[model samples]
Each structure stands twice: as structure tokens, then as C-alpha cells.
Target: MAQVQVQEDPDREERITMEAIVDAYGSEEQAMGWYYYLDDKITFPFQAKCIQARKVSPLKLGEVVEVTAMAPADDCEREMFVLIRWVDRELAVPLVQLEGIDVDDETEEAIADWHYWMARGYELG
Candidate 1:
């Protein structure tokens, strides 16, 4: 039998981490969109539908919620609805409603790194 050595790329690892983080919270259009903390109450650029803030898990403040999809609201003008995961109920929320919410430190860091990568012209896959 022959022995083989494997090498790793730190940059690639970082990119993979950033990609997973983005995929967990944001959409393809905005990978870092949901990167903020739940406590920050950050506002989204577009409105979401079916969101019930009261129904969010109180104990999962540090957890990340991904926006799976977005669609135009039927009853509103210039408003959109987004579907999020990790909640018990099917909730959509207006993007503006997310303002000022706090997020976990790891998520924040991942977002920052993702942004940095984007600024460097690294197209996120």
C-alpha cells in the first residue's frame, strides 16, 4: 500500500464557511441579507408576508433563520413576502420589519467575511 498526503486551502475553507452561512440565512440574490442578529432587528430591503414576530422562538436568539423564498404580496403595493425557516409556523415578514434585530456573533462574522470577499471581486458561488 502507498501513503498519500492531502493539502488544504485556508481560503477555500473560509469561502465554504461563508457560503454555508449565507445559504443558511439568505437567498441567492442576497446571501448576506439574513446575516444580522435576531436581536438587532435589522430591516430587510423587501417586505415579507406571513411573519409573526411574536411566534419566533425566544430561546433561539442566537440561531440563524434562512429566507427560502420571496414573492409579491397580494394585498399590498410595493410589498413582498418572504418565507423563513426554523420557526414552528409558516410566517412571512416584511423586510422592513427586520430592522434593528440582533444576530449571533458567528453569523455576524461570517457576513462580514462574505462582504469582504465580495468587495475583493470574489463571486460567491
Candidate 2:
């Protein structure tokens, strides 16, 4: 975590910690921890806006989408992804790429926790 950019947030620190990462070891376990952490926290059908663009994702910056669910656990083994509604289809996009809007506090905090991990150069796989 040498590249971590420090910004104080006790809530974020508390929410995204080793404890949430129940038992097991290695990167796979860590991935599963985050998968369930997000799954249990984020409410479905929340609205989000693409805050950043990625080459592998079709989402454009500032595009708004309805986040329906977490992507398959296996698909999120490396980085987290969420299923979002797109033109007549649902697409899985990186969780870090979106910012929640009109979402509950838990969902907002969960996304921020993922962003916090990403900002620190953390990856499960």
C-alpha cells in the first residue's frame, strides 16, 4: 500500500477492514470478503453516475445508470464489478468507475470503501 493516498475517514477505515474479511487466507479469500461486503451493503436498483472512463468498459463519463446487482463472484476475483442497466442490456462495470447517487448511506459508504482500496493500489488477484 505504498501508493496509498491518505485522506482521513474513520468510517471508511472501520467499514473496510480485516474484520469484514472473515477467515480464510490469500487473495481469493480477500476477493470473496469484498464481494460479500459489497453484496450485503449495497441496495439494489440504486442510481449511479460514471465518474471515470475505462478502456475495457463502455460507460462514458457522466453517464447515469441504474446499478442492479453485483457481478458474478468469479468475475470480481480481481477487481469489483457491478451490473448496470445499459441500452436494452445489462453490463458489468468496475465498481470504482461509478459514484452512487440517490443511494442509502450504507451503499455510499461501501462504494467509497472500494474506492479507498483502489486508491491504495489494492487488488485481490
RMSD to the hidden true structure, all candidates: 15.7, 1.8
Cand. 2 TM to true fold: 0.90
Could you tell me which 10 consecutive residues in candidate 1 have the lowest summed lDDT?
Answer: 38-47
lDDT of 2 by residue, 1-125 (tens): 44767566677666577545667378899899999999998999899999999997999999999999999998998889999999999899999999999899888988988888888776686
lDDT of each: 0.37, 0.87
* Candidate 2 Cα misplacement greater than 4 A, ranges: 8-11
| Clash pairs for candidate 2 | none
Candidate 1 lDDT by residue in tens digits, 1-125:
11222334477446645553444533333433323321123233322222234343232333345554442334112222345553575455443333213544443444344334333443423
Candidate 1: stretches off by over 4 Å = 1-63, 75-78, 98-125
